[model samples]
Target: MTAAAAMVRVEGLCKRFSVPRREAGLRAALRALVRREYRVVEAVRDLEFSLAPGERVGFLGPNGAGKTTTLKMLAGLIVPSAGRVEVAGFTPSDRRPEFLRRVSLVMGQKRQLSWDLPAIDNFEFNRVVYEIDPVHYKRRLEELTALLDVGEVMRRPVRQLSLGERMKCELVAALLHGPQVLFLDEPTIGLDVSMQLGIREFIRRYNAEHGATVILTSHYMEDVAALCPRILVIDGGRLRFDGSIEALRRQIRPLRRVSVRAAALPDDPTAMGRVVLREGGRLVLDVAPERVPEVVGALVALPEAQDLAVHDAPLEEVMRALFGREEAADLGGAIGHAR
Candidate 1:
């Protein structure tokens, strides 16, 4: 999207942190204390990307490929070391009231609700803090609580609520003001499968119904695969890939997985592709894209072929292939420490 038309615009974005350096020994430590040395660590490296209004995009990266750093820059929590960031036509670091009102941030690992108070009370506090009109606040609260099934949960003390309940309340608080841009950082961390699914569906529904631009970061591959159509892959504090999940899967792992279950298994399965799994009446292979149809036909012709399936490589595998063992380990360490 063009800069003028984009809801979020960034160029040459970078973040550098000055870290104190000291030796291990006591004498060295004392000397360092008197004359402390510093080293510059580049956390985000000349990143460039933009998001259109109402678009849900994901930032994919190892532990600390500057995903949170970039989010903070966009949210105006911290200023970028260099480059320009305009969200809703306002620079983030300015922390202007207008800009803050236009955006909302939800972090899974953190809590914005007061632990001792009921979430309903906290919502009231937020209504005042965000300067939301009483009528609009009541309407939005009812809408969110009903949609998330959190009407009763919001009335209980936040500390007494289950993690799922608390997360639902968090979502309610974040959306009560009708933000145009929603930034989510690990929005579903440490929840059961059912809870995760509920949260996932809620986010999708909220985005669709409100048309809020959603920028998300999640360690769970399923979350990104389900929520984001477009993804930005970052490694070593730099943009690596930007495209749809299907495109990423195709680019990183070209093989198509074909599996079949037959009463009588094939004698020469290797002719089809690389054998991934083999057992009584079951065979799974990684076939080339062009050979998938031919292989599927052959497998289907087998006696009593009961179950047959064809799919691209899983998202986890695609991500593993995208980063090598040694390189990802090294970068994960340095970037994790920096973040």
Candidate 2:
């Protein structure tokens, strides 16, 4: 897609950093002071993707997989070493004021709001920074507060609020201007399950109402499952998988897991499927997708079978297997994220 038509567009994106190599120990530190050994690290390489307005997509990867680097580039916080990035019709590296006004970046590791003030005060500050009219700001604030359920605690000091409460207010502050695009980097980190669910719901509602384009990077699989229909998976500073969540599940791990709770132990669990896990009265089997129905039928017909359930393999295991395959094959080619 061209830059003008895409909410976000990237072509041959790369970000490289030179780092000083130093070993742990007083002698090594002292020696490195006079003569430093430098190493080039590529955070992102030849990355290309585009997003249309109102699309909610998840960015997935292990640590050091360039997720944050890509987000920072899109947010215009840093310039790429090479390549192009246009967000909302403006080149992010240019740091255009108009582009900044139409988007917001919420990073779990960083806070844009003042630490010493109440969340309401931060929201008011954003209103002034964005030059929002008083009437419109008030209306937006009311709507966000109602949606996030932060009405009562808006006046409370941000420092005193729990992590989850602070996260909700942080979202309100970031969104006070009604940004058209949002870059969320681990927005639900460090929150309880209920609070995480609330944040996920708020994100979905906000996107549905405003047609906001959202790029979410989160470790919680459930958050991605609930919010993103599509996902971009990166590994070792390169794109590994980009497609629907189901497609990723199928490509990385084609097997289905069938768990059966049996009334008694079977003479041979392998007859049903490859025994993956077994305990007191429960047997977990890894069966090919095509064989899942057959295996389940056979197991259900067994006299000892009590109950059976089938599920796709866990995402963590899929990723682990993917990386393992990459290591064995040594294939570092970038995978394009298709719309």
Q: Could you say which candidate leads in lDDT? A: 1
| Candidate 2 per-residue lDDT over residues 1-339, each given as its tens digit | 455678998889999999889999999999998999999999999887888789999998888999999999999998999999988889887888899999998977778767889998899889889999999998999999999999988899988899988999999999999899999999999999999999999999999999999999998888888999888887777877777777877766788999888777677878766889889888899898888888888778766787789999988787678777836223233244332
Q: Rate the local accuracy (lDDT) of all candidates.
A: 0.89, 0.86
**Residue-by-residue lDDT tens digits, candidate 1, 228-256:** 99888887778777778887777667899
Q: Write down the worst ten-residue block by lDDT for model 2.
A: 328-337
Q: Relative to the unseen true structure, what is the C-alpha lDDT of residue 295 in candidate 1, on a scale of 0 to 100? A: 93
Quote the lDDT for 300 in model 2. 89
Clashing residue pairs found in predicted model 2 = none
lDDT of 1 at 156: 88
- Which regions of candidate 1 deviate over 4 angstroms? 21-32, 325-339
